[model samples]
Target chain A: MHIVVCIKQVPDSAQIRVHPVTNTIMRQGVPAIVNPYDLYSLEEALRLKDRYGGRVTVLSMGPPQAETALRKAISFGADEAILVTDRAFAGSDTLATSYALASAIRQIEKDIPVDLVFAGKQTIDGDTAQVGPGIAKRLDMRLLTYISKIRELDALHGTITVERRAEGGVQVLKTKLPCLVTVLEGTNEMRFATMNNMFRAARYPLKVWNKESAGIEDLTKIGLKGSPTIVSKVFAPSPKAVKAEIIDTESNQPKDLVVTLLAKLFTKKPDLAHDIAKNAP
Target chain B: MSETTEPRKPARKKVELDPKLARYKGVWVFVEHERGQVHPVSWELMGEGRKLADKLGVELAGVVMGAPGEDTRTFCHQAMHHGADLCYLIADEVLRDYRNEPFTKGMTDLVNTWQPEILLIGATTLGRDLAGSVATTLKTGLTADCTELAIDMENRSLAATRPTFGGSLLCTIVTLNYRPQMATVRPRVMAMPKRDESRTGRIVEHPLGMIETAIITKVLEYIPDNLQGKPQLAFADIIVSGGRGMKKQENFQRIWDLAKVLGAEVGATRPIVQAGWVEADRQVGQSGKTVRPKLYIAAGISGAIQHRVGMEDSDVIIAINSDPNAPIFDFATYGIVGNAMVIVPALTDAFRQHLSTSRMAG
Candidate 1:
């Protein structure tokens, strides 16, 4: 019944600004936060640990500052925290990332058998949604992604029933334990850290691992070298050829504006006019 | 087939396609159909696929997998008119309901057997679900929610451009070593190519070796969503979107009121969508819908690259945030820096006054 939740510390994309000169993200003053989506996964893992009376360990991979993210997870009531920070691990893609995470999990399993692993459905920064499955593939663990609800878990039988989100509807699938689960947002609410747990999180001695400590055997497979996919370049989206045609109404009348806008829009695309008239009350 | 980064273009080296890559042939657009009808996004992908095929000098093919019926065949033919050079049909009774196991098996079978260098799928809820599983099963890389795709003249690499940094920046990804460069494009990002009814393509049919009872997932019931009150922002002619500029959850009511008057659907930024103030489907941002509403009224929304990626395609972008410095004003045609709560209600009343009178006068 022991659980592990993986979280990442990402630049608050909301507040991130690009340097005009460098054309790179300005991170000096940017505040980092645990990915918003990871909260649901962490909370779900904490809930299962609470119900099953087991321990939960939170793990993060980033710069040394990522220790704060691990501490934040502990404050949220995870029993233990681990930080896998290494210079070599930087610039890793989803493929290399899954390798590092899976290696760390295997190391953890050597000490204590992990019954379940939890991760966010996808990272906002990457949005690849590949790490979870990649980790599952490497670790040979069953993957249940975009899970909305955990209907039941039978510890004795090592079986779990969960509802997975498909394209149009929910897929109620039952699978075995020692697997990985990626939780979707709105699945559960995150709880505020109590005064007591906040103190514990502040004091929690984090276990930091580097390339050697993480049990990464192949130097080639743990970072950029291990990554098969590469980001060739980044640039701004090209603007549209023609600028938007503004609907002008000299009358300064709100009704005049809305009507004029519609008239102009439908005049160019007459089928749109039929749709609007049909949907009108 | 050639893998040579020919030093030619200033932007970057040409994608080097190996001469051995000649074995990889045909363009495949994964036809994402469900229920009784195929999703329109499939047709959109087909249109884009035709261009990629034309560049590679290969036949454009559509891979349609669904339950056994005429609908699956009908979709294959429809795909051809949309510019497919061929259709790869895999229909079975078990395929009727969309299941990961059966659908993944069917697709991977066609891919491993036929060897397509490029695979495209619509970035629908179903598309992401199916693409993830198929890519994993095939051990191929998939770039999701691509905003652009191009062929490298040198290496013949399928250069996939997508919004990154939560849509703040755009990054181009290339699957260098992988055979089939798999990608999923969101709906509306690509223009629907002209459909030619006179166009024809070869049809290749394959059998779904499995039966219905063998599939693990059973479609017990489909609770049809009540269509009366759903936001049809994707198909709407005018979308009056709101954001944090509305300030509070309750203030969105004014935006809704204005939208109702203009016969428009309401849209919001990602933060608003994440806040549970609006449905995720109605969210307008990089991670949400790529909208092309005729008239986009962005109330209280400060335009970020993530939010801009979704609504930048609109015919008209009218921004109404309290701060003129808000990025929304930069590209917006009509910028009104005022309280959305106040401005939205005023606009709502104004539209009602204007539209109602115009209806009578006309």
Candidate 2:
């Protein structure tokens, strides 16, 4: 079995902050790391490779610096890494993105047939969760998303069974092989890299593919030209003009504070107090 | 994912939409259901769809796909009560369970039969899973997790506004040249409209010409989540969330105490959940559940944009933090500067007493 995992490099969201004055992202100090969600997908793919004795190839589409993410995947036990980057692919939205990545996957299929494709549920930056399905539709593969567990995989029959998370219950779905699966977060814990794997990752000669090398011949379908949506305006959410009314008391003790706050709350909204009392279970 | 190596070129001019898409009219909301119960978010979208439909002087319709039973027909009636002018119904045995293939085919077939200019769906797991595939198959643009939806009269396109750049900024996206502009809004982000039982509308029936054998994916088993002791923060009227400022897991118990006294749900930030102070299901933020409660009491939360966007829509916000300059204070209706450990226990006791006294009086 040949499994391909798609990953992305995104800024660590915890360190991301907005400038108070200009309302722009403060990206200077934020470090770039593998998308936290993608790690789960990569880990799932590696575990499948371990069980089924298959080769896992990690793929990403980003700038040259994204090679670090691919190498990190290699350290996690991936057999190969490919980075798809190009000057013409700038300003691409999810549609253009899936097109480029799908084209790259087709090129990879020339060497070996890929039985399964894996991707993170969504990226932290876009959080659209559209690329996986877009790629699945473009490739004419069965798309299974928000998969929580891999119940069974019958490679001989070209069939796979998995549990998909739905609104109120879990749906155990069985689909054909050669499909795309978007793994959900918290599905599995990523494994720690071994020293030998780290050394191999450091020396692994990565495959770099551009738009031309990835077999994307349609210029209009690879970048900004293919994106149907446009951002008309980007602005900070306006803060509520009036600040919260601070309750003050003579003594700053917890008892005094509670009394004062309750008095004010009841005075302002008598119905809330009554409702809470009435609905007390 | 590529970066611009050279100077960026000027923005491209808007392209003329295909003439074929001009015939698409009306706005449709996909009414999501599970185990014969319609999700409330579907009704919320129906209310919002009414506004969009009225603005364009077009009809508002609800799309319902389910088994051939009374439940499906009842949902179509309820859809009209919630402001839908009509409903498109598709019934089949294959769609009895929520498999991606049959549901997607049913929805896409409806769109193709009677094209709707704007389609709104709830951003639940099932909705998200279905909308992406349907939109991709139709080769159109879809905006997910949109906080705001408006019709741009200039070009008569849907303007979908959602948080971008990790919730630091809001960007309004428009699918200028795509027909049946699609968007998914999370539950509770939109107000639930009052239902009018007296209202009735037309029901348009469509057939799902799919068979069990033809569909490759099969539903093996379904295990419903155990909701007995779990926190239903998404629909909770009141939520008390803790952040990193709680210091330790023991101190986090104050949140549970307060929630108990007030009959509210307990929520925690991502960091707190990561630190094992609370379960992942109780986390409320961008990465967690989006909640809009009647009252939200945030303790020790610094009001990071990610967490703020999730609960900012609550009717009333009360923030307690040591730092007065915390972003929570910027939007909170009431703010207290102090230790959360101290404030939380006192509030719980006060509510406990207040409720007991009221019960005695009544």
Candidate 3:
């Protein structure tokens, strides 16, 4: 089984802060990490390789710096890593990004037949969850998204069954091989890197491909020109004019504070108290 | 240096749609249903679609796909009650359950045949899965988890506004050249519309051409989630949520205590859930449940945009955090700048007493 997992490098969103006055992203010192969600997909692919005795290839598309993310994937035991980067790929949205990645996957297939493609459910930055399906459509591959567990994988029969999260229940779905899957988060724990794998990751010669090498022939469909959605404006969320009314007490005792708060709350909205009383079991 | 003085025009060119796409009309909402019941978000989108349709001077329609039954037709009438001017219905045995291949083909086929200008779907698991594949098959654009949807009358396009950069900033996106511009909005983000029983609409039937044998993916079984102890945060009248500041898993109990006193549901931020402080289902944020409780008390939550977008629409917000500068203070209706450990218990006791007294008085 040859599995290709797509990962992305994104700024650590938890530590990201917005400028107070400017309302712009304050990204100066924020570190970049492989999109957290992608780690689940990478780990799942590694697990599949572990069980099937096959190779796992990690793929990513971004600036040259994205090679770091691919290397990080190698540290988790991926057999190969490919970074598709080019100046023409700048300003691509989900549509164009999938086009470039799909083209690169087609190129990768020429070297080794890929049985499965794995991707994070969505990126923390873009959060569109569109590229995986977009690529599946372009490749004419079966797309299985929000997968929770791999119940069965009959490589010999070219069939797979898995639990897919749906609106109200989990749908146990069976599909053919050579499918593209977007794995949901919390499905598995990512394995820690071993010393031997760390050394191998550091020494691995990463493969870098640009638009032409990636087999992208249409210049209009590989970048901003190919992106159908245009971001017209980016602005800060307008602050609510009414600041929260701070509840204070001179006594500074929890009990006293509670008493005062309850008194004030009931005085202001008697209906709330009545509703709570009525609904109480 | 001698340079041609025509100020370098903005490098980006204004997008012009192919003349073929100009005929697409009407705003359509995908009426999502499960187990014979329609999701309320479908109605919310219907109400929102009504506004967009009115602005563009076009009809608002609902698209319902389900098994052949009266239940499917009833959903069409409900969609009209919520504001749909018409509905497109597709019924087939293959669509009895939510399988991506069949639903995507049905939806894409409907779009190709009926050519709606805009398509709205709830950002649920089923809707997201279907929307992505449908948009890809049509070679169009889709914006997910939109906070606002409006018609750009000047361009006759849908401007989908959503939080970007992890909800720190808001960006308005336009599918300038794509017909059937698509977007998904989280459930509870929009207000539920008044159901008008007097309203009526037309139902145009479509057929699902594919059969069960053609779809490679087959549903073997469906195990419903155990709802015994599940929290209904989306429709809760009151909610109390905790975050990383809760310090430990044990500390989350205080949030539950407060919620129990008020007959409310308990919610947590994503990090807290990821840390194993709480179950994943209790999480409330962009990646979790979007809630619109009547009163939401956020305890120890710093109010990141991801969490805010999920619960900011609550009728009233009360924030309790030790840090005075927590972002929750910006939008909360009331701020209690104190340790949640100290304040949550107090609020719980207070509510207990207050509720008992009210019961006695009544």
By TM-score, who's the top model here? 2
lDDT of 2 by residue, B69-103 (tens): 89999999999999999999998888899877899
Write candidate 3's Cα lDDT for B189-289 as tens digits: 89999999999989999989988889988889989887777777788888889998899889899998888788888899989988987788888987678
After superposition, which runs of candidate 2 have C-alpha atoms over 4 Å from their true positions?
A: A278-281, B1-16
Which candidate, 1 or 3, has the higher TM-score? 3
When candidate 1 is compared with the true two-chain complex, its DockQ is 0.32
Please tell me which model should have the higher lDDT, number 2 or number 3.
2
Clash count, predicted structure 3: 0
DockQ of 2: 0.56
Q: What is the C-alpha lDDT of each candidate?
A: 0.78, 0.87, 0.86
Q: Clashing residue pairs in candidate 2, if any?
A: none
Tens digits of lDDT, candidate 2, A1-281: 99999999998877888888977778898999998888989999998999988899999998999999999999999999999998788777777888899999999999999999999998888888888888887888889999999989898899999999988879898999899999988899999999999999999999999888998979898677777666766788988888788767888887888788887777777777755654457
Task: Return the TM-score for candidate 1, rounded to 2 decimals.
Answer: 0.88
The TM-score of candidate 3 is 0.95
> What is candidate 1's lDDT per residue for A9-117, written digit by digit as tens?
8878777776656556666888889988899999999999889889998888788999999999999999998899888986676667777888999999988999999
Quote the lDDT for B60 in model 2. Answer: 97
Error of 3 at B323 (Å): 3.2
Candidate 2 contains a number of clashing pairs equal to 0
Docking class of 2: medium
- Across B61-157, the per-residue lDDT of candidate 1 in tens digits comes to 9999887678988888899899988899997877876656688779989998889999999987567656766776676667878988898767777
